[model samples]
Every structure is written in C-alpha cells, then in structure tokens.
Target: MTDQTAPTDPAEVTAHLDARLDDDARAWFAESRDRIGDDPAAVRVLFPAVSRRVGRGPLAPGGDGDDPFVWHRDDAGRALLLAAVDPGARPGELRDCYTHGDARERRGVLRSLEVVEVDDEVTAELVDDALRTNDVRLVAAALGPAGVAVLDDDGFAQAVLKAVFVDLDLERIAGIPDRVTPELSRMMADFVHERVAAGRAVPASVWTVIDRHPPADRLAAIEAERDHEDPHRAAAAAAALDARP
Candidate 1:
C-alpha cells in the first residue's frame, strides 16, 4: 500500500490566485466603495462572493484587519483595495454581487431600488409587441429558450406564434413568400417538424396558434416534414397534432 499524506497549507493550495488586478476592475471597486460607504460586514459579503466566483478565497495568513486580501472585512476599504490590486477580479462579478445578492445587500450597495412584476399575460404581450417590430434582441432577451419552453408547456400558442412571427417577420400566414421571410418560416417549420419526427409533442398552445393563423396546405406541409430525423421533436409534433382536431 502507498502512504497517503493530508493536504498541507491552504496558501499552497491557492497559490495561483495571487495575480495582479486590471484597471477596469480596480476602478469599479473604487466606485463601489464610494457608493457603499465604509461598512466592513457589507464589504466582506460582497468581496467574498466576487472572490468565490473568481477562484480566490478571502484571506491571507498573518494579515492584519487592514489586510486587503482578507475576505471577511465588515468595511468596504479592504475589499475595494484588494479588488483594485487584484487584476484578475471581474468587474461584472462585482456588479452581479451588487445586483443579484439579497435585497438588503443590494439596497446597501445601490441605495435605491424598484421591483416590477411582469406576469405571463404581460410578458406575452410584451413578447408579441417586440416580435411585431422585428426586435430580435428584445424578443430573445424576453423569451429565451427557457421562456419559450415555459410558454409552450403552459399552452400559450398564440403568444408563441406571435413571438415566432415577429421574430421571423412572417407577413403571410400560409403561402411561402419570395423574400427571406419564407426561409425563416421554413426553418422554424423544419425545427418543429424535426421535433415531431423525434416522437416529441409540440406544446398544445403552439399548435393552437398554428391552427388558427396558417393556411391548411402550409400546415400540412409542415406536418409532413415532421417525419425528419429528430425523435424528441417528432414526439412533440405528434402531441401538437393530437392537440388539434
């Protein structure tokens, strides 16, 4: 049997994290300090979160309370100083610490806050409006794949259809047009078709929109294409078809 030794120094374990800080991260840390005042506990929480994400622990051995590398300070001074010095620290991570942390922490950092709740209907409405304007960025941001999945699962076909229509800029419902719109339509259709071919069901809501908006021939063509190679999509398409009359 081989002899096993316990891990020795924590410092040795994390020796690689001692890199210098870049200019932007340093500037942001200074700004954060000015914004949050000199609260040690607040700084401790904020810095540790950033350090954790950046692969640095909060403390260095034999360091004083003024030690910039110590992760558990209650004031912003050390944290800001450490961040300013450590070039590898990400400004985005620090920003996220201010934004995504608990309410109290965020309030402490930002000083003012507003809470807005956009429900399904409102979100759907916003998505629809965004799509109609061909606002790809807004549409994608508002209804990411996860949001799309949620809308599909919840049977929000009209919403999905509107989103797709707007995103693809489909002017005609049934016939394949001459412009790039048809290509986008075909691509989306093909995507659904593959899903159906794979033995997956399209969300019922998506089916509802397809049924109401598109011409029968176009719909049938899309259905026929469902026999393509994706099993998961195939199943979804079958479910979507079943959801229709």
Candidate 2:
C-alpha cells in the first residue's frame, strides 16, 4: 500500500495511477467507481493497486471478460480499504484509491475494508446506500428540514421523526411545512403525538399543519389512534382537542 499520507497532491496521485495501469485497467477503474458512487478522488487511488496484481488483464481467461481484480460483490469495498489505512482520509479519497488500484491487488485490498463511519450521511449518499442504516446520532447529524422531507417522502418517516425529536426545535419545525406533503403532514402529526406522550418536547410549529389541512375532529381522530398505542399520547391528544374549542 502506498503511504496514503505521503504528502501527495491530486496531480501526483493521478500520475502515479496512470503509469501503473493500462487502458483496460483504466476502464475498469472508471466502471467500478461509477458503480459505487461519484467521487473522482476515489478513482485516483484505486486503479494503481489493481494493475499491480492483475497485470492489466481481465479476471478470468474466458469468462465474462470482466476485470476479475475488481470485487463486484463488495459494493463499498473500495472506500473501506482506503479508510482502513488512512483513518483521517475523506470517504471520497478512499473510494478513489480502491477504484483506481490494480486488479490483482484489489482482492487483498478489499479484505482489509471496514465500515468505519456508518453514520456519515455524505458517505452514505456517496456510497449509494441508505441513511436509515445510520444510528440516531448519525441520522441527527445528516438531517435538516429538507433532508427530513426527502426522508419522509422516501417512506423513511419514522427515521425522520426520530431525527427531528433529537435535533430539531420549533424554528426548524416551522420550516417543515414548506416541505411537507399531505401524507407527510399526517405522519408528522403522529410523530408529534408520540413525542408528547413520551414527555419529550413538542415543536409548536407542527400545529400549523394540524390547524391548516385536517379538520379538528379528523386531527383528533389521528391523535386518538396514536393514543391507543400510548396512554400519555391520549392525554396529549385530549389537551389538543380541548384547546381547539
């Protein structure tokens, strides 16, 4: 493994990779990196190592003629390998090293791969993976009003609500309406009820949606449904209902 911290710049890294691999190796590098995610830095580091092991040829003699050095089964292996050696390196950089490294060297490099920061949203998105797999702390770090709306629409409302409860406040919730769909609005109401029931703080801005779309009785019914699962939520629903008068 080349010293990742060898004080090399982007240009130096690119030159090193180009000299070590041929046209076939370069093509595999591009394809593999694209399959993982877009991050040019990752490609720069992966190709040279691959070329070293596979001699710039396809993996099998007469198989699919695919670059056998590249580990297609491990989606994020390239990124993982790079991160193992250089803990402080960015996800993009690590991804580059694996995708551009030599074919023969690719397999051994992949075995060293690890999922160091599962909670990094940028890494998650770049790796073409789901953020829901992240911890609450990671989810909280990744979320904002816009991200929340995206997550909600993608059927990740539960995750979004969890993030909101942990990180968002009234001001943040106030901005949520702009991103809320009718479906998401209802989901948000349910989430708020859950929080209130748990004696967790409720962001007052959520009431804007509750007050605007659904009639009071309808809102009450939604709250009642939530209350069924949690008694404290029932009391909170009752209070919201009484306040409506």
Judged by lDDT against the true structure, how good is candidate 1?
0.37
Query: Could you tell me every candidate's TM-score relative to the true structure?
Result: 0.27, 0.35
Candidate 2, backbone clash total: 25
Q: Which candidate is the best by lDDT?
A: 2
| Minimal lDDT window, size 10, model 1 | 1-10
What is each predicted model's overall lDDT from 0 to 1? 0.37, 0.42
**What is the lDDT, from 0 to 100, of the residue 102 in candidate 2?**
42
Write model 2 residue lDDT over 1-245, tens digit each, in one string.
11121112333333434454568756775566463355444445554444342243322223232422122222222333343333444445544443544433333233223223323453435222223433332332233322333343444445445545554332233134454556656766766666656645555555655554554544665456545666766665666545442
Q: Give the least accurate 10-residue stretch of model 2, judged by summed lDDT.
A: 1-10
| Backbone clashes, each candidate | 30, 25
Cα lDDT tens digits for candidate 1, 1-245: 00011111223222312332345545554465554444423444545344323323223333343221122211122223323322233233334444454422332122111011223443344334433444433343333322233343223334344555443322212221222233344444554565566565454334333433455555686566447466655556566676665
Question: What C-alpha RMSD separates each model from the true structure?
Answer: 17.9, 16.2
lDDT at 9, model 2: 31
